[model samples]
Target: MNENPHPTRQLEEAPVHDQFDVTLEDADLLGEVELTTNLIIAASESDEHLEAEEIDRILGVVPSPREDG
Candidate 1:
């Protein structure tokens, strides 16, 4: 076994923000997908009444999707 102060593997810090993808798609279903996952958050009209996109189209209101129970 190697016991050295220097790590055999390198670690990266302060990653470049541009390298991350932050685009939301239209067909993304609100429930299954997490808003904070994959550095992207999708927003669209809420199916409050199950009408689908009839009203209240999501537009970064909360940076996450809210499903009605």
Candidate 2:
């Protein structure tokens, strides 16, 4: 029932990386599945979904971008 008789016939490894990694995250993860490679925003539940507008409203100040803009 094995498609490939030999394991050494892997044409590629790790697969191709998509140019972008855009994702829509929800605060309430009630019935959601936890991916092993998900970009977890915060360690605590109280401080989640770090959107720019949300961040500014919370901290009462504009937050610096983590990555170079």
Encode model 1's per-residue lDDT on 1-69: one tens digit a residue: 778897687677876788567664655664325533321333233233422342224333333577889
* Superposition TM-score, candidate 1 onto the true structure: 0.16
Candidate 2: C-alpha lDDT: 0.50
Q: What is the lDDT of every predicted structure here? A: 0.44, 0.50
True lDDT of residue 47, candidate 1: 30
Highest lDDT scorer? 2
lDDT of 1: 0.44
Question: How many Å off is the CA of 52 in candidate 2?
Answer: 0.8
Query: TM-scores of all models?
Result: 0.16, 0.21
Query: Residue 9 of candidate 2: its Cα lDDT?
Result: 64
lDDT of 2 by residue, 1-69 (tens): 767666686566777778696464764452233421222433244455556565445434666769966
Off by over 4 Å in 2: 1-43, 46-48, 62-69
